[model samples]
Target: MEVKVTSSTILPSPTSHHSDIPLTIFDRFAANIHIYVIYAFTPPTPSNADLISALSKTLVYFPTLTANLSTDCHGRPCVSVGGPHEDRGALVVEATVLSKLEDHLPLTPSPDLRLLHPDAENPKHLLQVQLNRFQCGGLVIGLTSHHRVADGRSMCAFTIAWGKILRGVPIDPLPFYDQPWLKPRNPPLVQFDHWGSEFIHLSPQSNEFIITRTDVDPSEITNLLLHFSPDFITKLKAQTNKLSTDKHTTFETLLGYLWRKMTIARQLDDEECTTLSVSVNGRRRLQPTVPPEFFGNLVLNAYPKAKAKALIEGGAATAAGIVREGLRFIGEDYFQSFIDFGEVYGDRDLVPCFEKDGNVLSPKIEVDGWLGLGFDEVNFGGGGKLCAFLPTWVPFEGLLIFSPSLSQSGGVDVFVSLLEKHAVTMREISHSLD
Candidate 1:
């Protein structure tokens, strides 16, 4: 499993914004950490030179991708685009592996998978990419982006746009950057308990994972990839909606089932409460809803909690209801209040409140749903399209991602990190409907 680094270069955008793009409050609310996306393509993919050239041209439409992250003299974070300190660009690393791609058909999350992507520690550039070429001509494109610059949807848009440009196709929905619309209203109307829900009196502990930043070691985390077949998804949905006619979505039912499984695997006490932090996008929930194509972060978490006894004893129907109820709590008013909160207190540094009941080893799990984001449309031509897409590695405990599987069968792929012992137990019971 040796990967030889052939070249490392900083590729700048051919065009620049020539201005400092101040991050919106939504951006500020998102984690300030680097997240990776890996796309494995079968042999007959485009050459590195052609792909890189296409990327350079694509960055012209996304100046924020080429920009460096910095702060204003007032100390608020901002993206410096073609400024006095503007040599910054996306980092591209090229490497080659001696083995054939067939050895790793369905890639899973593991510590060794970290080598497939650029190192994220103290990253200089906001966006980074790695090209891992196999002897079989198969290519795995690993991309990383600082969460503040964009969200998962934005990254998908950028990747899809890059692929389209490589194939000489027009970008259907051009990237939009009308940020002033997100500004807090004049004489900002503050309406929610944001300080209690979003901000903390103490400084952040580490990079945000869902909502909890902890001192947990990466070595203790166990990463697993569980694929749910379409048939299995249908079964889970039936079980989730059996007790009620709420008609929970695939995301809700799936997440509800997972929360129950993990909770049972953890073997918590009957009275103990477990909170699941679900990522909710404020784009369509806003007053005059933000465009789905808006390229920035609008993600906030919805906290769904139930006693471990209730989640395990009450069945999938109860769990799905809890999940839906929590998500419904964060509506247009919820988003507007967050915006108003940012307007009033954004200048002063604010930390996210990690825990509610002061539980140290908090019983919280985080999840993000990445279905229907147009991942299937990312095709670089040359007889190669997306064979698979997944996270390089999940290093934190109690975090999960529900992604649409790129397999021909069309199912769901669940990538998760948990305690080693719990992960082992969860794996044994992952597919069991009981």
Candidate 2:
């Protein structure tokens, strides 16, 4: 891979807030995601200067796409609010010409991204690029994004825009990023009181994954939208209402089912405790329904407890009921009060970090409504429809994803990522469901 840094543009400091204060949603989460593409070009090699120049033009409209912290400030990315320094974030476009991609490069699917490097500690800025040449005349564009500002869907939108710019076309109706709907509570409704006792951040914990050698090949993890007919989903909902009325819980039921399956796959010892978690958005849980367009991260995790032996031996419906019960706790009042978690847990000296107790298996479940907004419609100059992926895995060894699928079925698609050895166990658990 031939790689060279051509432009290293940094944004100027913002006059908006003082250094000691915590950053606002836009200040903290606003950052660009870096994407690299390995393009396989034919004999007519594209000129590096021209390619960079065309790409730069795309940034003309999206001035915030590229940027880093300026010297005047403590390296925080510049904001778009005021002064000449405002909107100074510029993309660093580098063109690397490779003689042969295959012979010279590592063929692993994932790019080498340094996660905890000292210089790369910020949550907003990410390093990335596209190698125009490879051994087989192939190109590899690697993407890295700051998880703080944008989610996977937001990052992919930018990539599609870049592709269109490369093809020399106007991006139709530039992406709308207005996020007025996610306003913080006026008095700050929820307290962060119990966060310290109940939750664990990634700091100081060895939440590292011990990768075991496996013969299983990594493949494109596609979304499998489970089509539980409306009737089926309805039945589940009914079950949930009944369970909730009895104060048993429905979310817990689902989690129990999933937790059992995951544990059975791993064949954990009978005495082990298995943990499963889910995220609840605190937006509408307040006095008002959060605006649909609200975009910042307003999530909280829910961990339901269970013994591996119990989970592995439980019936499917029984497990689902456990998860359902757990979910009922996330009602409007819970969300409304949860807003205060910051205050509740702020004094406990909990810096953000991953949790790694190693004794339990915790699986996280998240269901966001971005699919309803038609993320597929995000197009730039018609290069094509955009496809997206969430690269970062939560701390849990087992992760279950529920997202909108491209099939337009209005059904949810699920993806599970676990250790390779658990394949047989997972298959058996899945078979039971079938």
- Candidate that would win on TM-score: 1
lDDT agreement of model 1 with the native:
0.81
Worst 10 residues of 2 by lDDT: 109-118
Local lDDT at 22 for model 1 = 78
Give the per-residue lDDT digits (tens) of candidate 1, residues 324-411: 9999999988888788888888887766565322212337887888888777678899896578888887667787898888888989
The candidate maximizing lDDT is 1
lDDT of 2: 0.43
Model 2 C-alpha lDDT per residue in residues 272-335, reported as the tens digit of each score: 7765556555555545665433433445455555677776666555566566565556666555
Which ranges of candidate 2 are over 4 A from the true structure? 1-21, 24-142, 151-193, 197-258, 343-348, 352-377, 383-396, 406-415, 427-434
Alpha carbon lDDT of residue 113, candidate 1?
Answer: 65
